[model samples]
Target: MGKEFIEIFEKWADTYDSSLTKDIEYKEVFRGYDQILDSVANKAFGEVVEFGPGTGNLTVKLLELGLSVTGIEPSPAMRKLADEKLKGKAVVKDGDFLSFTVEKKPDVFVSTYAFHHLTDKEKAEAITLYSNLLSSSGKIVFADTMFRSEEEYEKAKAAASQSGFHNLAADLAREYYSTIPKLKGMLEENGFTATFTRLNEFVWIMEGIKLQ
Candidate 1:
């Protein structure tokens, strides 16, 4: 499944950014992301490590804030695009979030529209890994598809399928959508204080601060 996930992104790399930008729903999501990420920038500290930085859209914004960013992207093609977009402003690493290692603990760890690629268990494990990689005051900020509950997720999946959004239906079937309440519980269980900001019914930004 992991290899397949990587392959999917690799295949979509060239068209990924364009597809998101051209889709009205995704365009609105990106706009909301801009605002959410801007708020993240205000709270960031020394250095930031971004997971799956697709084509450097949010990476550019973090760079503009004068923050040093290290981006981990699994797809070579996508990494290449991000490298070109970042233009030496940030370091692009060829790896996935779950296995990547950092010599120094980052002050902030962030991801946008990326975590949904993982399954629920993987998401929990990733959060645990992130907690271990942060200092007491460090934070983790994420912007992605966040559902209110399992019921809401099911309803959305049904709606998408009925509307001919097969890809979305597939994602739902694969358990790629995160439920906000579940996520917050996981974060808190792992010793982080969590907060959520909803952008819409399906998208949200979350911040978790390591407890002292």
Candidate 2:
């Protein structure tokens, strides 16, 4: 993500939430983020952090788990949405996800429906950054519908080339990142144990637990 892209998104920040959930279909799909958080409530996550918490959808749910949460969102409009929904429950910082270092590393760091927005290089870099912030036994969970296999990605790219949705699909093509296998490898190489496993059909929650 560059400064230019950040500025571009800031312009759309006000209406971005509307774009994501204007229709009933989108509303249900987006809620998957919250459901992911709920599913892991009993995992005993300590202090938590959520990156790219657009509209505070997951931020609110994470706080409800009784874990102190710090949500970092770059877009002002998105942060405002988080503020309105979170209501002082969690700390919200308006900053970039790449280098927003905190004084204390949180026990659990999670993000929902936002990781796809990063470039492949950034995605790999993110795993490194998040790994550095973990406690010895810290856990991380990344939940998104955007993860796709290499074959599916190739098809999507081909479809985009011939279809009128060139721009829209292009974003999806890049934003969705890779399938669970690639993601798992990245996590493991970065010192995370285990790998990506299926949590469900529609949802993919790849986790990494730091080795003691």
Candidate 3:
């Protein structure tokens, strides 16, 4: 399933940005990024790392803020587009977040609409790994499809069905969506203070601050 998804993304890489602009839901998702970035606007972060940066939309924003950014992406085609878009502004690497390495520990980590590709257990492990990659005062901000509970997942599924998105609804009803409470627990247990805000019915932004 993961490989299949990567293949789909690779195929869509060239047209991803243009396609996103036409998607109303995706536009709303992009709007959530502003809030995510604003949440840490006051922080003094020297370095930032992003997971699956897609075509560098968010990477451009991070670079605009004058912070050095390293983007790790698995899809070669996607990385190519990101490379062309980011150019010298950011270092785009060919790797997944779980195994990617950097010489310098980042002051903050950012990922938008990418983490949901992992299973529940993988998500927990990823958080643990991220915790180790951060400086003592470092933080992580992410926005992705998240549900508060099983009930909310069911509600989203029903709404999707009513809107004529049968396949999408079924996918939402399955184990794809992250559970907010579980995510919070994972972050906290791994030594970060987690906070969550709903961006929309299907997306949520979360910030996790490393504990001293």
Q: What overall lDDT goes with each candidate model? A: 0.81, 0.69, 0.77
User: Model 1: runs farther than 4 Å from truth?
Assistant: 24-31
Top candidate on lDDT is: 1
Clash count in backbone of candidate 2:
0
Candidate 2 residues lying further than 4 Å off, grouped into runs, are 1-34, 40-44, 146-148, 156-170, 174-176, 197-203
lDDT of 1 by residue, 1-212 (tens): 14458877878888887776576534544565557667766667678998988888888888888888888888888889999988888888877768786666798998878888887798899889888888778899988888888898889889878877776678667757878889999899999999998875577878999998
- Candidate 2: C-alpha lDDT: 0.69
User: Candidate 3 residues 1-212, lDDT tens each?
Assistant: 13436876887888777765575534544555556555544343788888888988888777778888888888989888888988777888877757787768888888877887878888888889888889987898887888889788778778778877665666565445678899999999999999997766567778899999
RMSD of each: 2.0, 3.4, 2.5
Candidate that scores best on TM-score: 1
109-188 per-residue lDDT for model 2 (tens digits): 78776676676677789888878878889987877654457776667567656666555455555454667677777788
Score every model by TM-score.
Answer: 0.91, 0.79, 0.89
Q: Which residue pairs in candidate 3 collide?
A: none
Candidate 1, 60: how far from true, in Å?
Answer: 0.8
